[model samples]
Target: MQKRAFTLIELLVVIAIIAILAAILFPVFAQAREKARQTSCLSNQKQIGLGVMQYVQDYDETYPTAYYYKNNTATVNGGSAGGYVHMSVLINPYLKNAQVWVCPSDALRGVGPDNPACADWTNITQIGCEAQVPRLSYIPNSSIMPRKRGPQDAPNVVSMAAVDAPADVIAIGEMTDFSNCIFLGSTGQQNNERRNKSHRPVNAIMRTAGGGQWAGQSVADVTGPIFAITQAAAQGAEGWGGPADTRAITNTAGCRGSAADGGLHIRFMSPGRHSGGSNYMFADGHAKWHRFNDTINPNRFLWGRTYFPSGQPVLDQAGVQVR
Candidate 1:
């Protein structure tokens, strides 16, 4: 019976060992979890890319229009309205999973009164009128079209074709808010509450034709310059102006200024923060982590100069061509 006695020192040693192990293994576990999430996000982007490719095959060679206006009121130069298509909807059939509409890392999902959780995507629908269309969380390169006033403005229309392989062209990128689709230069301009929260100064970079003062005087408004054409075009879309959807990442440090509205922003699959890296699926159908600043070239990132009145460039992480 006396052999069963245990000393306090023995118990303390055991507890110390456990504490040490926990300190060592906790980070490893956390890293592993993040890695898994990142992989899943990449897969989602690849599937969406495939969906875009499928849509292209079904249609002539053109990609889905990033966002279509419903009525004639929102027309820049008397273009037809309605039938606006966002990359999210275009690829919905291809991804075969509506959940891909949201990024796993976005913290804004289901956060504030305005924030909808990633799971609530079931209720998420494209917003806009026939003439004035809304913005989507994602945009496709195939959807990028010439900004000419013509018959291309129709419902479910595929305007632009992928100039390069599916892997070379960007399929989807982060959209500011659904309201960003509204024309920034017109009376339809609606101030987005998220704008104040966005890391980028939406009002400063948005550039209203009336020359109104930028909204919100917070010093935290540190959005980068609106670079790249495609990003600028996507951002220029009536609804493309707004704050970053933090729900996608769900964390503050990973938050970035919303991509320039118009058609230049590329929506890629991202899950959690990758140490300032996001997941993107190239036209070649491969997923990789693109450092936010890794622009090896500049031409690949430009877009929408001839279409929109503003000829801005959407620069990539490394200042490469992301138009």
Candidate 2:
């Protein structure tokens, strides 16, 4: 027998075949990977839901305050009397793993714990710790809490027993890198600080009209770089005393706007992290995914006045719950 090697033509044919196979299989493989990430993200949310339920059980059926406020402040954990404590601190103890707070597909993974961009639930030093916001991937439903910017003396705590439709109302879900709606420090003020300064007030475009902050405003009219707008607009319209009346998308990709001096706007929007919807933990401790439009369209009735525990038609200017 004589030693033989592949001829150039034959080698070229094999390489070409491989190239064709790679071209065909690469997308399939990418899709598979994404699907896995979505599943993992769902699992993370489910765990968080369980954690919240556990906390509620231990805390006399009362939902944990969206964030632990320092003194009387709401600017995140270390701003002053109103600093916000990370919500993760209140729920993570039940999860027993800080990683549950992160989504596998997170794009801005911070340098802290787990190599995933999420809050450092394992080592919570204080409210403004540099490592906290980067790790938070989810935010709580603020509609359940008293308005953060409203009167400090208002009753702000939302008890789990108070949620009207526990199965339908959202308890927790994927949030944009930055948010202006109610939630704890993880998705609100503190989270905003770690993002690009040019992107200040990141999720403003999702504003809807109604609440005193953005009364009579529409999501369509608000446009432009978020930072260019005034702090109020940048913060998005908040329903100071009740459920935000406007609607918005889950993620903040194309969002833009500045606050109107005294216009009403809706600021709460869901994050569509998966195929076309986002994973959510319902108030009843069930975790599921919902379509993007399901949350955006008021007609669908996923996120809105119905979700609020207060049965009142409107919140007082002080943001007090009128039952």
lDDT of each: 0.37, 0.47
Best by TM-score: 2
- Model 2 — which ten-residue stretch has the worst lDDT? 197-206
Residue-wise C-alpha lDDT for candidate 2, range 2-93, written one tens digit per residue: 99999999999999999999999999998799789889988988887788789888988877655443434352223322334455666767
Error of 2 at 6 (Å): 6.1
Question: What is the TM-score of each predicted model, taking all chains together?
Answer: 0.54, 0.61
Residue 46, model 2: lDDT of 82
Model 1 misplaced regions, further than 4 Å: 73-85, 110-166, 174-272, 296-323
Per-residue CA lDDT of model 1 for 79-158, tens digit only, reads: 22222223454456566565664556444331111122223332223333221112223333322422222233322232
lDDT of 1 at 72: 30
